[model samples]
Target: MKIGLVLPVVVQHPSTRAEWERTAGIAEVAQIAAAADRLGYHHVAASEHVAVPREIAVERGGTYWDPLSTLGFLAARTRRIRLATQVLVLGYHHPLEIAKRYGTLDQVSGGRIVLGLGVGSLREEFDLLGAPFEDRGARADDAIRALRASLSDPAPSYDGPFYSYDGFVVEPHAAQVRVPLWMGGRTRRSLRRATEFGDGWVPFGLNVDELQAMLGTVDLPDGFELVLGSGRRLDPLGDPDATLRAVTRVREAGATVLGVSLVSTGAGHYCDQLHALRELTGQAGCTFDADPGHDRDD
Candidate 1:
């Protein structure tokens, strides 16, 4: 199975003061990402949020780095690792706008882009952005269609309930002919949307049993990817044996990519965890490769 990383600095919910201080800046983020790339990790991902409401800022911690900008910056720094938006809130931006930004990112990154999309659940944030909270699901569905159309062709066009454009072309089409669209959420609607439209599915908070049960209900295509996020931190400082077993089980349960959060007090600690992770996976006979036989660029 391929291992993907959610960089510590981008989210910033540091457990200790040392951890907080370690993951504090863009330079730190670059250093960590460069380490992941050099260590042979499959991908490095970042989260997104335009703005956080004051009432929920404390709970949310309000340190969300914009995914596009963060990934774009990392793209220039890393050579081989794939750049991903762990879950870009699709409801907040127009489809063409997303296409222009991320498509350009894909081109610059040398075809290493995985767009993880979601129907955002923050009602207040939606309100702040002037997006209709109630209709987010529908909007997300339409947005995915629009994104696929625009990203696939140089002169692209789409007609949908939420967005429409014709006789217009987006320049610098993505390096990959078809950029992978991974839908994220745990609801049945989310699963259906993924099966219907997305190239992959990224479900958060689902254990092995839960994922098996969900997979039993859907007819996953041969090349469709199932990426599961580890609900808890996969800390290398913890038990390496247990971590290996858990990773093995998840791989057996049919996850092509496992998203792991590396908790570190600093960049040095982060690199240590990554090296440990690589060793653990290597010992378990899991190999790393940019392509896993899935047609993500179809």
Candidate 2:
């Protein structure tokens, strides 16, 4: 299974934050990504939130680095490591705008981009942005379809409930013919949406049994990826044996790629944890070698 890393600077939750993360910024993030690249990690991920309410921010840490901007910056700093948005809230922007931004990202990143999208859950943020919070699921569905149309063709066009355009050309098409679209969330609706419209399903907080049950309901094809993450806190400076066991269990449960978050450790220890993870996974010699062209049509 491939291993992916989630940069610690994007979100500052207690479980994932180290002491130094409080003051960490772009340089720290770049250092982490560069180390991951050197360590043979398949991808490095970041999260997104345009704006958060004070209450939610207090709980979830309001310092979310914009995924596109962060990833774009990291793209210049590293090679080979794929860049991903853990879950870009789709309801916040038009599909055409998303297609344009991410398509450019793909171009600059040399075809290494995974557009992980979600039907946003923050009601206040949606209200603040003037986007429909209640019907976001329906809107996300339309947005995905519209994005596929806009991202794939030079003269892309789409007529959907949320967006409509015809014969308009979106230039600098994504480096990959079809940028992988991974859906994030664990609900039945999310599973259905992923099966119908996504190239992969990225679920968090689901145990092995729950993951198995969820997989049974979806008709995931051979190339359809299941990207799993350790549900509990990952203490990279702690036990390597325990981390390996957890990773092994998820791999056995049918994960194609595993996301490792070195959140509890400072940026200085990222390389150490990455090396330990590589050795634990027995993939020390592995490379970021997935065929970008292999799964072009989702």
Candidate 3:
């Protein structure tokens, strides 16, 4: 199975800034990403949040650099690792702009981009963004349609509840006709969305046994892709065999990628996690799958 690393982008609090400083900017992430690429990691992903529950205004994350922008920086620094979002909330940005942002990034990355999408549940963020939170799932499905059309076809036009546009055509079409879309959620809603539209499904925090059970119950589409991301810090999961077993189980359940969040209980542990995945990916003989493309000239 393919293995990817997730970066830490949010700031927890002022008191924790020292720990956060280790990861908080483009330069740091670029350094980390370079290491991952050299070590043969398959992808790196980011997360977006306006405000989270019970988060102190200061402790909560800042408006922060956008994911695509950070990804663009990573693209410039590395050639191999795919850039992606764990889930970029579709409601935060208009579908056209969202498509444009990713299309542009794909161009920069030379088509190495995977888009993990979701209609988020953070009601407060919607209130702050002036986007209606109700029926966001319906809105999300429409966003997916708009994104797909924008990436493919010429003169894309659409009419929908949350958005509509006419005569839309994005320049510098991606090298890959479709950007791999992964639906994010652990619930039934997420699973169904994945089966129906996504090239893959990324669900976080579940152990292999649990994932196996979940797979047995869900009606997965044929050849569905699964990416089981580790929840929490990476220290406990470093044992090579346990990690192998988890990824093995996920593969049998249809995972194409396994996202491991390097947990640093102390300092300088990220490299260890990278090495661990490198070994795992090597052993698995995971084939190189080209991600959805972007315009090289854009």
- What tens-digit string does per-residue lDDT give for candidate 3 at 1-298? 7778777543233443346554556666676777777766778888777665556445655544567777888999988889988789988988777777777788878889999998888788899889879878898898887787676544667777767889657665555688888999877677778877788888765666766777777777766668876544344345777666655655676677777665553323555566566556567765433333420111
lDDT of each: 0.82, 0.81, 0.70
Clashes found in each candidate (C-alpha, N, C closer than 3 A):
0, 0, 3
Q: Give lDDT tens digits, candidate 2, residues 1-298.
A: 8889877878777545778888988987888788777666788988888888888777777888889889999999987888999999999889888888888889988999999999988888899889998888899999999988788577888899878999777877787988999999988788788888889999877777877887788688769888988765555458876776777777889888888776345666766676666666764332344344421111
Best by lDDT: 1
User: Pairing residues by index, what is the TM-score of model 2?
Assistant: 0.92
TM-score for all models, in order of appearance: 0.92, 0.92, 0.81
**Sorted on TM-score, highest at the top, how do the candidates line up?**
2, 1, 3
Winner on TM-score (2 vs 3): 2
Off by over 4 Å in 1: 14-18, 21-23, 290-298
Q: Give the Cα error of residue 33 in candidate 3, in Å.
A: 0.9
Instruction: List the candidates ranked by lDDT, beginning with the highest.
Output: 1, 2, 3
